[model samples]
Target: MAKYKGRILFVLAGALLIIIWDFIYYFVLQYSFNLQVDLLFGTLILFIGYYTGKNYDESNETVSAISKSEEKIKRLNEELHLVLQNITEVVFHTNSKGEFQFLNHSWEELTGYSIKESIHKNALHFISLHERHEFLRVLRRSISEQKEKTKIDFSFQTRSGQFRWGEVNIKLNYDENGELAGTVGTISDITERIHNEEELLEMNETLAIESQKLSVAGQLAAGIAHEVRNPLTSINGFLQLLRDDADEKTREYLEIVFSEIKRIELVLSELLILAKPQSVTYKRINIVETLDHVAKLLNTNAILYNIEIQTAFKQRDLYIRGDENQLKQVFINLVKNAIEAMPHGGNIMIEAGLNEYNKVELSFKDEGIGMKKQILDKLGEPFFTTKTKGTGLGLTICLRILRDHSADISVQSEQGEGTTFSIKFEAAHQQERKKREQTQKVW
Candidate 1:
């Protein structure tokens, strides 16, 4: 409508000018009407109207194109803002001086720092002190190499003053002259991933050490069982025969000898368990029932030692796939250790429940004298024990049994603060289905 109005106004003004000119020529100039002059004047007016209208249409098209482009740019900016606000990772932009220029909503969510307050602050300030040097080195190296993109994993400090693992991917921005202008990057929370990786690496190291111990045990097991046990058994029989005829003083010595022989036999048996693989019956067994039986069996022993044993379970029907006897041994060892730790008679709390992963978790927490870090680290090693009479193989055998049942064991202890042993196993249903799938695949 507006474009047409401009054309209409031009045509009207041209027609009015032609009328005035013709009137002047006929009335004021006192000249007779000339057909050629009127025709030429009318033709000139039409030509001017056509030329002005064409120019107005072209100008209007250019204005419309500019308006559409601006609208497109506005829509795009809105979409970008929405994405940055909703993403889980922190999106950021920094100037060449490493000062923050822009931060998205996730930055506040992750670091507990408001975006408005964080802007213009040095980004390196949020990185852990120990990692800052490495971060700067990486940034400088990227710029020196003229790399457009780079990545680094660092510990990022939050507003609460705790550090979390973050993996940052950076894309360098440059001016037209190729000088560094700033950087755009995203930081993702990798705390869980880093923890899992550390656990896996520690587990691998532990397995390597256990493998070496097992090799040594295997070499010693067969020799000791066959070459030494037979003679010891014969000598034990003789000692018992002689014990009946010995004097009181001699009897005391014989008793000590008998106890030592029994200790040796116990050690030999545990070595066999650790060094050799036994037939395991994998079936769904109620873990609650197993734990209850262990508790009952040890109740008398615990009472004699001036200790009390308590049992608690989140559910009544907790089940797992494992050999009942082997599982019982593991629980018994852990409970007994707890009982022994508290010589002055403290309570041992045995609890079972489902963990976050939906796996069965059984924990034994004891109010007893705890171990130091060095002793705790050496817990599962062969011949490692804190007790005077311990064969040092009991806990190792328990660990081996649990490992065969696909269970994980962890211990926490602080000097004078007591200790807790936690064991995790796959739920019975999950384990059963996993085995069935494996069997089917094998067939």
Candidate 2:
């Protein structure tokens, strides 16, 4: 009876333990506590899980954005390198005190110095010492004014110890707020460009010489033809004399010879001026008197073109020491050019005034077909003419004469507008002119 009573107690205790286990298994282990037996472990695991998931998403997004940014930067760097690769000219940046700050691949290649060597290098070392003060003054002024573009020519010694002429164009570098930053410019290897231009000029000069030679040849041919024709004329006269007594057929042949001889003389006479250039006798003559004379000579043409010819000769006596014939030629050429330019009637303004330097400035402006810039550049070159029937030597000869007389000429022409030629000579007092002439004689 005691054993049965003990077993019954054991069984009741076991049933109570099972009910407690079942109560803890589903709800406590999953929600309140874990199998680790420490209540703190359950709390720690819950906090860690939520935080790790949030951290992982944020990190992944940040990494992806950073990768894209890196790719963009790499592409830009490649583009910059490619653009600067083939340039042979020096491209650089410098500060106010002539310290080099940035230099491109061209600057490195041209100077044979790396960017590291160029940094903090004085630009004065590159530019000439004599022009340094003047040079910097201009640069600073232009920068301070925030001039967008300014071009200046300077001579500099390169890293190779060679002097080079650089035509540098600088623009004021400004920040976002319009404050001056520094100067940025490109240094072109104008050495080759200049050399080629000089070569081209030399070649053009050679062509001019050849053309002059041809002109001489033409003159020689004309002179020889003239002499031959004169003898032939005499021979034809004798033939005509014979023909007077000869048969009809003989007389006809003689008439042909006589006609040919006369035709030859006309062509020869026109070309004789080129063979024997006329020497000028310069004299100090009053120009007003000659201008009066020119008025009468050009009157016919002025009337023919229905052009209004006007003169403004109010000065007492403007004397010039030049050949009368040559000066007349110059005036004639100018007037003719102006008249031709104005096919339709247009006003021609002629003014004689004393320049600021007191030089005798004679201006002839015509409202006519003006010229292009390209044409003006080679204005005095022989054979460059706007006229279809122009010999093209008129302006060339005029320029030569003006230069010989120690005078200067300036011309302004524009397309479809008008052309103006300003002629200047030393308008020193008559006494001063004599003094200069005497000084020249003594020297």
Give the per-residue lDDT digits (tens) of candidate 1, residues 23-139.
Answer: 888999989978997989898896798679768877888899999999999999999999988999999999988899999999998999999999999998889999999999998
Q: Model 2: how far is 373 from its true place, Å?
A: 3.9
CA deviation > 4 Å runs, candidate 1: 33-51, 67-206, 241-247, 436-443
For model 2, the local distance difference test gives 0.73
Give the TM-score of each candidate. Answer: 0.69, 0.45
| lDDT value for model 1 | 0.89
Residue 311 of model 1 has an lDDT of 92
Residue pairs clashing in model 1 are: none
- Go through the candidates in order and give each one's C-alpha lDDT: 0.89, 0.73
For this target, which candidate reaches the highest TM-score against the unseen true structure? 1
